[model samples]
Target: MDVNKTYKGVALQEVLTLLQQHENTSKVIAGGTDLIIQLRECKVTPQVLIDVSSLEEIKGIEIIENRVSIGAATTFTQLVNSPFLNNGLEGLKEAAKSVGSPQIRNIATVGGNICNASPAADIIPPLLVLDSELYISDINKSRTISLEKFLIDKGQVDLKTNELLCHIQFNNIKNNQGLGFSKLGLRKSLAIARISVAVWVEVEENTYKQVRIATGACSKLGVREREVEALLLGKPVEEKTMQLGAEALKTQLEKRLAGRKGMEYKREAIQGVFKEALTKATYLSKT
Candidate 1:
């Protein structure tokens, strides 16, 4: 167990150089919410730790043109207080607030949450529904990945070891859009989600135009329920339509995690959550 000094840097270039020089095994320490736990458990023991906490390059959120770019090192608390998203992206801001606890949110970052790559990651579901894109940067190569492709597996990603996750970017929402988020954790606060659902819908008159619903924790990875979206598209949100949409989403989740041991509880719970989310969104759209 070699802890090769805690090296701190002020610039991104210097951090990148230190990270790249250590072969493909070094881990960058950001908020250290998840990384420190993993390292102490002996699950990961890197010889080099390139601390990026002070690097000014990957911090803060910005609205450039129509796109909303969130820095990799931005804290969850920063997101929870963002005026631009206070109403437009309420679900995302809510999800950030709900992650871990106040203490964790004060330090845990969006990049750290995504990098952990857990199926139940509290933030991934909302980001998926929002259609956020991930920017991954390596010293030699850089690329962008859709939220769907970023989390390739339960604990794996297209992110190469040499690459550092830069940030997540997405477009601003319109006034007609209503957003909702719900999570089934063991408890109310500081609990990891057993299943989480996020829904975003744009209502044109009484009909739904663009709808996005994403489920996490239950599946191998968080993803949008396209089948459910198709049913809700162009359809008026009413008693019958909402029921059908909920059932459709349930069917899709069951198919993905066919033999999951918690299917009995998870399937029933997700349907209820998605239905409530849709109901709330419709109610909000009307007002």
Candidate 2:
């Protein structure tokens, strides 16, 4: 990638202050994973670049007393190797694994993924199911926002121009909760997702306790299939229920993407994927 300039060996506070100073002209470059590609494609150009890839405050995963918090600068490889994340946030770990080539995964930051806000971004579906929240900071202030309401549209988020993505946090699944993640792409390797789904369910006393089913690529954003969830609530986790839930999810997706091409493939593919995922989650939680 070609660039007019580069900034190195800068402190985190310096970068933040630089962004604050430049304001409209500044863009933070962490890992340069998405920014380089966008620049090469001539998609965007900013007068100033504030590099923060080496900032310690933006680079770890922690499971605190209440929730799991991952720094914005944490890379895919870090998430994949994290025991706490791998064991508890399997859906997120799996989604991170599904990203591009090894080199791309090594350099792509979680903050970039969230900020880029691609409708097809692989991790968004899993995060939506977690009902995650983002912590965004600027020189002046910081705020927390829900995942559902944070992503606005294609290539847009609730982030202010000078603000930075600090971290992402979400509670762990309850003791009896089961979670699963899957993505359908043109190829299993580097392709962007064509359709993705993540589901979580909690069972107690042989009955459905709570459920969150999220689907991406079909909608303008990742979405919860509420009608199907309504059907699954209090329903037994049997083959019949799985089939019904999956089929209903398919129907809802079809209705949502009514006029779009590729609906046929997405509708059929999602049913099988959702069923397999929900079944595995339910079974694994029992074991």
The candidate scoring highest on TM-score is: 1
What are the RMSD figures for all models against the true structure?
1.6, 2.1
User: In model 2, which regions exceed 4 Å deviation?
Assistant: 1-3, 9-11, 86-88
lDDT over C-alpha atoms for residue 141 of model 2: 80
182-232 in candidate 1: lDDT tens per residue?
877888998988888888899987889888888888777877888888888
lDDT of 2 by residue, 6-47 (tens): 565245666667667777776778878788788778787776
Candidate 2 local distance difference test against the native:
0.79
TM-score to native of every candidate shown = 0.94, 0.93
Lowest summed lDDT across 10 adjacent residues in model 2 is found at: 1-10
Residue 13 CA displacement from its true place in model 1, Å: 1.4
Off by over 4 Å in 1: 283-287
Q: Report the C-alpha displacement of residue 49, candidate 1, in angstroms.
A: 1.0
Best by lDDT: 1
